[model samples]
Target: MEEERLSQQLHEYALWKADVARNLGLYQNFLESQDNEDNELILRIEDIIESLSTDRIVIAFVAEFSRGKTELINAIFFADYKRRLLPSDVGRTTMCPTELLYDHVSKESYIRLLPIETRLEDTSIAEHKRNLDYWTTLPLQVESPDKMVEAFKEVVKVKRVSLEEAKRLGLFIEDMAQHLEQVPEYVEVPMWRHALISFPHPLLKGGLVILDTPGLNALGTEPELTVDMLPNAHAVIFVLGADTGVTKTDMDMWQEHVKVFSSGGKKGLLVALNKIDTMWDELENSETVASKIKGQCVSTAKTLGIDVATVFPISAHKGLLGKVKHEAALLERSGLPKLERVLSDEILPQKQRIVRDRVINGIGATIKMSRDSVKRNYDGTRQQLDELQSLDVKNNSMIAHLLQMTRKETIIYETRVENFQTSRALLMKHVKEMQEFLNITELDKHITAIRKQMEGSWTTGGMKKGMTQFFEQIRYNMTQVSYTASKANESMQSIYKRFHEDFGLVDIKPSILSMHHYDMRMDNLAKRAEEYRDSTAMTVSEQSFVIKKFFISIVSHARDIFAKAFQEVENWSKSSLVPIAVQLKDSKTALQRRIDNLQRIRDSKETVEGRIDELNQSLADFEARLKQLNEVCDAIHKPLSFDQPPAEAEDIKQQTAS
Candidate 1:
């Protein structure tokens, strides 16, 4: 029964991951054409949508130094973990934030990480010698557990003074040095803001992601990681030492930082009174010491207005033996199991309900985002339509006006081109200057120790090659990812920006303006996506919102006409609108090309994930096949020596001689 149930869980995780992948593709497509004013807000929405796919229930277990955070996780849920025990050496098992992920792929186990500021390939020992600021912002995938462990050993041992070390470098400022002093002494990833330890847990692999972060002060606090990562968590097991009680730091972590999310957000704080084994070693009356500590932990939780489930008194160092009497009871009382139930049986299902709400929320959210994006095309179209309204376009009267304008513009272009040529040169120079802000290649060197372990594996070789090929394709695709129904409308914006000095044509300039919807093509692509999405939203429903169907129909019809006008980038110089219209139309074609490319990639991913699903069954099949082979190959007795072979041959020879 349990085997079947586990198989079901594995299956569900696979489906869940696939569903997320599908949603991610949707978000990726939505994000591709973001070429205008509302992009920042759109990006935030994109972030929410993106998080919905990956880090939905990121329950981070954070604590101060040597408080037994790993032990606490192990104590509550070690029975069915990928391994029998959590990795603990010397004192701390985690020198970084070890994220325990329930990887829907590779049902067995995986430990992954996104490095602080380095891409994998560029990160090498030599790079570390240069400086800390050279790393890229790209995500880094750590190798398998054994290899990651080897690399981690080196990362922890590096002798260089961390950024914190420099900041706290004043030899006399021992007391004043706040963040930096924690780095030189602590065993965690010395320089990084957060070190990730991602693996498959028995319980969490069902649907949980248990993050074991290093001691807070020693690890260095990155507000982005906390701000982005923590609030998304479903529940937080804030582990503290029962023996030590709640320190000022611990109290601050709970009261100030943690409470921010407890209201309407999915995240909440739960205190764990870990390392209760130390109570037995006390010279002061052990019972009194234990009781006093437990009371304080409860008091701390009460101060925050949360139920203190159980102050678990555990000896995580005891190595999986039966816990002490008090510890065992505390384990039963600890809110982890309750918390797990809340996540799986209730919260998880609740989240599913929201997602499966007949795709209403997803459809609404996506459509709303799309309409706002496409509004620019409407504005441009309206301006052009008003220009045409003055002359009846259907009678070919406006065509003459267009011809006149084009001829007039032609006369001015010679001078405009001369001025434009110089400005364009200056703009290009400034662009190169701004491009220098992008160099993070130096940061990769510090993490070089990890790259060593990735060498010479068959799968690793294939993955490296595959990723290189993928990135190559991405480089090209990024240049022309967005599609539009009208090319002419987009070309106008491009033409306007190209010659204008303010639009950046000549010098080494920072593409800060480019950060906005600088790409006319991108704008057109966004407009196309928005048109489709809005058309979807405005579909005649059983219930009518605000405006009745008649007005909405008129507006909807007007919007389409506006879109047509918007796309008509009729070059006044050109006789027909065909040239620019064809260019805008290419966006649609461009969009289709991208979709085709993305579809092919999706098919490949689907196959890979499908193959990954068959792994356990394949493993079981392989095990049985090996067992059969072993039985057949068994030499229970002795080998067929020369003596035995010769006797059989000699008997045959004797019979022939006789």
Candidate 2:
């Protein structure tokens, strides 16, 4: 029943995304029909449509070894097979970080594995994903569940390697070695570093992605998982063992990795207390067992410094069994239904809200500008028609007088155009200055210099100092960019105001370039760097490995932030002066047309009634085009139905306790 609910919700989400894309396509068509010259706006809309078409909702499962994380995933997503799909039993099943998704482009089912030896290189997992040569591929026969299971077992494969090789891979630590009974010549390690499984499941085809991660050791060795993949997931489920009730290693993983999401008020950070059947006793009554589980839930929540409402107690083992056997009572006793409901209720709506916000912020202003332009043209055409109808055709002197007045008006408009060009040149100078502050090439040079300094350092203190200086320099550069953006915004506003005062053009507010978000991101990166410098993991890892991981994870993230800022500035430069420029050109063309009509009438070459008939036809065309523009704007802003009924409080209390 819970699986059905999740699948239905995913289906609905996919439909909502399609609806949005269809409307955007209509808007694109409208622009092309009107011969809209704002190519940047059209390109942005196309990008948004492409993003909606290929977007994936990622959910990451995080846990230490023997925590039932894999079993829970099987119970929730793979129960339609009526059996366990992935290799999940006893001590350690998923030896590497595995990603389960559908390959829509290829439309094929397969498993791709990256060799553990890739850790010796400086390339990140994300980079390795783009190159097919680095991974081994195997075909998946979805028709037979047994064959699929046999192929999936390869994710759990391991090999024994020399101690030196293990240490070089950053998989062996002194703290773990001290727990061994005696020094060994070899250590056991996973053969694969990462796994990618593309299957044709209903939910996967609907854009659902599952990331099943390994224990703390693997997470520590692969810095990219902690720094990029997990943080970017739409939701994170941190699983814990009910019998052990949050061990030391579990607490370490929570504090180092998962706590950041919850502390920052990010939604969809859920705690699944798995293996609850261990607490079920036949000697005691059901009520007594329930009370004990409730106490454990309260205790775990307090220890973790999280809300008890966010903690879910469930038995993944029994859930899977009951699902396969088709027993409703057993599935209800497992307490898996409630967790699934909350996940579906929370994640889908949140994802929709994010997409909606992006659409509104990205192209909402451009649509409005297009509508305004259409209305202005319609109004101007009507005024010209009224003026021509009010004229007397038999009086040549009157026509001659009107022609002289129009010629003088044309000259005045020409003077204004010259002034506009001068102001535009000044605005371009300020734009150039802003671009210099955000140049990506200049930022890369700074990064290269800092990396070299850290590489040459002989002591840990020197390396730490180098990292601190790197952030300080980045912050300084950001401050300069922020100041320049403010100055440019002020200049743009002044230009718009002058046009409104001089001519009758509407006073449109130009787009402002805000740097608050980028500033906050840089500050967060600095905090992460500070924490890494003081971490025990850094102290135990080799010096070379430490430098490489720091640059790959932390520095690379900072570079991404700067690159986005640079792109935004470039977009602002293109779009800031568009509305006024378009209006000026339209007004100039209308004046020239009016002057030509009066000149023809004064020369006795055309009748006044004939000119009037042509103006009336042109006015009708403008009205039709204006109506079409309004309809396109309305479609783009239409609201989607993303409402989901809230779960009852009584249901939450029972499920949280169970």
TM-score of each: 0.39, 0.92
Count of backbone clashes for each model? 41, 0
Which predicted model would earn the best TM-score?
2
Candidate 2 at residue 4, lDDT?
86
Off by over 4 Å in 2: 34-36, 537-544, 603-624, 643-658
In model 1, the Cα lDDT at residue 654 comes to: 44
Worst 10 residues of 2 by lDDT: 649-658
Instruction: Please report, in order, the local distance difference test score of every candidate based on alpha carbons.
Output: 0.41, 0.82
Predict model 1's lDDT versus the native. 0.41
lDDT of 2: 0.82
Cα lDDT tens digits, model 2, 1-658, are 8788778778776776776687678778777776545677789889999998889899999999889889999998999898899988778778999999998887889999999999888777888888888999999999999999999999889999998898788777777668889867898889999999999999999899999988755666677777788878988999999999999888878877777765457888999999999999999999999999999999999989999998999999999999999999889999899898887878866886788778877777777777787787778778888887888877888878888888888898888889878888887787787677777788789888987887788477777887888888889888988998888888788888888887866768888889888998888777766765565554344655755675667877888888888878877877777788778878876888888788888787888788889888878987887786676566556554434234453342233233
